[model samples]
Target: MSPVIQEPAGIFITLEGGEGSGKTTQARRLCDWLTAQGRHVLHTREPGGTLLAERLRSLLLDRSAETIAPETEAWLILAARRQHVDHVIKPALQQGMIVVCDRFSDSTMAYQGYGRGLDLRTLRTMNKWATGKLAPHLTLLFDVPVRLGLSRRRGQRSSQNRLDREATQFHEKVRAGFQTLAKQEPRRMVVLDASLPLESVQRNVTTVITRWLNARRRQPRQR
Candidate 1:
């Protein structure tokens, strides 16, 4: 696919959660629904979106790399976001396409801030610079107990991601981090019960998204 241009006017929706929260599943579902509604949709994932970002993804997710410190890992994530923002996401939105990102800046706060106990101030600063003041129009936080989520992860053999290899406590912290963020930004973030059946969760998600889109459409364009 050709690259999307910079400065899109469309809405950006991000799905955030801990492991096994169905972000990938729901993100794709949302994209398909948007397309069925005749809206231009772009589905992407964090730590990866642009070509360069994918390369960085490999380095960041290599579980065997024991020497990578937490601070370094956070920087790598931010760097990938910088590239993704400038090269892919920003452009897709400029074209007025709905962009469903599997994860975004929230993941950084959850993983690096809460999980790794990094300085939130530094993370926020880096995030602002990387995203160029671009905030998601809406963020769906798939809330689930860390134990259940991590247990589900143990059954998946294909996930060799280093971040996925962290201890259960780390994941618990990540979940707590997302919860904190949701509380702090209730207007922009909606925490959804992810333990429900996929269809049920999807229905709720569709309802919320449809209403948000409809409302946006009804609003008069600002000069």
Candidate 2:
């Protein structure tokens, strides 16, 4: 595959992890922190970010009477992604706004490809087509033990979704898949030990993001 061409006009940051990895919380906090610094940041999430995409997200996550096949699931997510990239992500980037997304392409690779036993290469091709090869400038993968993560979800007050109800082994596969991706692309993907306390994880996240943004600002533009 060709190198991921991150949007040159703006920075795109994505957060990925298994269930209850605290990525959602961290995403919100990061966005708020960035906003306080007067950065033009747009906070969004995959399988969401637009009306159509949110509808698809509901269908994808809701525990329905009808069982969705792996291929069907992959198709729905890709469709949502297409909507998100075209309607939400690209426009923000073109305006030179920092976009902080809760989840993105890596989630599909982990959940649909590895967790659902689909073909990773096929998914990649589809994703490339769907997003026109747009990829994140940075991806933070908050990894936690499968059992602990699942337990955290169960302890949550909110209703559990289909993914939240997945079996232990399934979630294990997803976490492992995320770790593998981080290893494969260390420059773009940073792995965080989410098992740490909330403040510790949040501090690590903000510190890393601040340093990354500073580093990018110092680099000379490519011709």
Candidate 3:
């Protein structure tokens, strides 16, 4: 099946990974690099792009006094996604900007579905409805060992979220889930060895994106 395009002229790229995989840093670097090349770029993150969505992000991430059920977590994430799509992502794409989102639908599939034992099929369907079938034009998945990623997160004690505190087994499941996804959609999702030095990863990211844009420029535009 063909992918959905929020806007024909815009490029939507997402950076995804488990905790402390360095996707956030890479995302910012991508935006900066694109801007230097004269591309109008919009950097945003899932669960926190719009005002309403940001509120939901806080609710989802903060150490809650109550346990958040897996289903409930999925519902809230999709709700935030709906707001993000309508208020932030779609509009930026409409203006013909490169939208650099830090996380997107795949996070839900990996974290809640695989890690928390929710059904992947159900989450995929829900994600489709929530985002109006919007999918990233390209997805860069930063991959690292769960122990390594969690160890990195542990070093950042001040910013630890509830997800960060999950058992190592949970993170391993999420990592495996992302791997399965990358293998399933090899064309769209590029997996990077995130354990590499920061400079090397950034170089690889820039090279990959430049190549993708050049290839797209050669292809006939789709209506």
Candidate 2: C-alpha RMSD to true structure equals 3.2
lDDT of 1 by residue, 1-223 (tens): 9996544588899999999888998998989988998989999999999888998898888877667888988888889999999988988888888889999999999999998999999989989998997889899999988777776777787884676677888998999999999999987899999988889999989998987777777872420
Residues 73-143 of candidate 2 have per-residue lDDT tens digits of: 99999999999999999999899999999999999999999999999999999999988899998999999
The lDDT per prediction is 0.88, 0.91, 0.91
Model 2 stretches astray by more than 4 angstroms: 1-8, 220-223
Candidate 3 ranges beyond 4 A from true positions:
1-7, 220-223
lDDT of candidate 1?
0.88
Q: TM-score for all predictions?
A: 0.92, 0.94, 0.95
Clashing pairs in 2: none
Q: Kindly report which residue pairs in candidate 1 clash with one another.
A: 5-91, 7-94, 8-93, 8-94
